[model samples]
Target: MSDERSYPTGIGTSTTDRIQLLGLDLADEVLGKVSFGELAYWLATKRRPTPGQLRVFEAALVSLADHGYTPTAIAARMTYYSAPESIQGAIASGLLGGGSRFLGVTEDTGQFLAASIAALGDTSGYSEDDWDAVARDVLEKAKSEGRKVPGLGHPVHKQGDPRTPVMFQIAREAEVFGPHLSLFEAIGRVHPEVLGRTLPLNGAGVAGASLADAGLPLGLLRGFALLARTAGLIGHLAEEQQHPVGPAIYAEVDRNATYVPPAP
Candidate 1:
């Protein structure tokens, strides 16, 4: 019965010499015909992307590829320094930090936007104020309950995330700009009126909106984030080889730590 509990997925399969993905032969049918971004979409969704969807997916992947000196990159570098033999360990450690608002905000924002849209189902005649009110109410309620609204603010780029505008443009060009994107934009506009501050669109917010608009599954957003950053993590690890910054980062953090002496 243990073997009877096998799980099934349409993702991919491998044999001795052949690999297949989404029913297409990997080497013969897919290798040169598709970009990695398009292949990525296929692996996740079991379908090919429209040119527009490919653009947005590519943008999201590139946008999150590497934020210089991010915690994830730092962790990857440090892990590489400590365990030079285990590059995979470094990558894994970096990805492990990507929950909540860290690097996983793209997933959080997508899920949040999906839920918000679902809650406002059948908006046949919702006026601008009505939709805005609904959004503000939702935001306020989440705030009152001390919930972290994913993908709104950023630590740096106070004016706006440079990536956000580009992602929005890509979505617009792709014609995938839908309610989720609108909801995030609306939230941005109504933020000052409702929350007494402006929280402009960040990259994660754009990622969420774009993926949702592009019709990707909400549950897969986190996986997408990890995949996107894996490219960046690989870059960081490679850089750590020639120009090692991991030790310096570690030493700087160590210097900043205020040790509390244990009771004698």
Candidate 2:
């Protein structure tokens, strides 16, 4: 007699595996039960934050919703104008341009300050003298390296970035202060001297720091920034529909250039 017992080949394999992998069990759990707000609350908190926390989160989102036609917004608008049927494609085009270099300055700012702190060790606490020493050292290094401090200065906002103070205030109210904030404050103190004028925290810097303080991963910051900017991009798309810029404008062509003959 054969020693082996007969077993169906598909029984413990494909058929059973397919049934186990199917998510039909959770079907009823997700059927028209939650509104977007409720869903967002659930996802964010695993429950829900206090009303106050919700308000702060809303404010942050609202405050960052738009900032004119930045490069990303322009790209989005251009894509939308060309391909009106695919809004997602336009938005994706815009998002591709959104990165840490574009909208989140916290990592760079944190790195700069962290380096300064390490260089100045034991002198980076809350003490004014300690802070000043660190700032001076960082500033000198920046000067020598011909690099600007990341969180300071803005091209368009001459006086100061209006968003900076608001974010700092929000962080204070939320009672969440960490190394990012300390670096921001330190940079704020030194920026005036370094730039020969007062430099206010820009939106990117504030958003970066706030997200970092919230214990969010640095990689997610760019997505948040892009999401915030999408509001502005949509608005621009709408405006462009009303009053279009026509075809793309290019720099003047060099009509006098000599043409080379193709190889024989």
Candidate 3:
């Protein structure tokens, strides 16, 4: 064997004379030419998206960016309050809070939709009624298994999630609407019959379907949500620097705590 080591990556690389990303000149072809949203999709899929795909992808990103003082945002602000000097820590604290109850739903919904679609085998020429039937079966199986449907409801949006329809519209206009989205919409239509009363297809779930339809990898759906939320967290930190509510939040919770003795 020769005394040499090789590292291979399709993402990015740099040397003395040139920097390359996704087989393009990062300085000449990418910078000032590609939007950050487009660049993110290109970097992830190793394939440049069409204008429609980019629109749908970025819409998904924007939908998941922030939702006003969610636990992740609070965690970020509180971490910033506790460690004012470590901005990265504050951002990390926010991202770390993206779990099952929060940002993780993006991936969960995408995976659920994808799995349901895959189970249909040959899905060619599947009509709306066919998709609704598929959606019914999917919900019925999930109900039987006692699994909470990830993107079916929201805490605040009892009437409807405004973002859900907007995402569907964007996907429709972009012409990137695909099976995942079709199935999700079917779920919205037919879920009342399966699970009783209606639940709006929340934004997070719609974002997942939108991302999946945009041809992004199912596994990286949550990562995309986190990428968007990173921007939101930075905004929160900037506000924390200016108006500074982290301490107030901390104080409110701290003052409300009551001590309760454990049984001996």
Candidate number of the best TM-score: 3
List candidate 2 stretches off by more than 4 Å.
1-58, 99-101, 104-107, 110-125, 195-197, 238-264
Which lDDT tens digits does candidate 1 get at residues 188-262? 778787778887789977897788888788899888889989999999898899999878878898999998999
Return the top candidate by lDDT: 3
> What RMSD does each model have against the real structure?
2.6, 8.4, 1.2
Q: Is candidate 1 or candidate 2 better by TM-score?
A: 1
Give the per-residue lDDT digits (tens) of candidate 2, residues 134-253.
Answer: 677677778889988877767788677888888778777876655666666777787677657786677677666665555444545555566666777777777767876423421122
Give per-residue CA lDDT, model 3, range 34-153, as digits (tens). 899998998899899999999999888888889999999999999999999999999999999999889998999999999888867877688999999998999999999999888999
Could you tell me every candidate's TM-score relative to the true structure?
0.90, 0.66, 0.97
TM-score of 1: 0.90
Local error of candidate 1 at residue 50 (angstroms): 1.5
Candidate 1 Cα misplacement greater than 4 A, ranges? 1-9, 15-17, 123-131, 253-258
* TM-score head-to-head 2 vs 3, winner: 3
Question: Which model is ahead, 1 or 3, in terms of TM-score?
Answer: 3
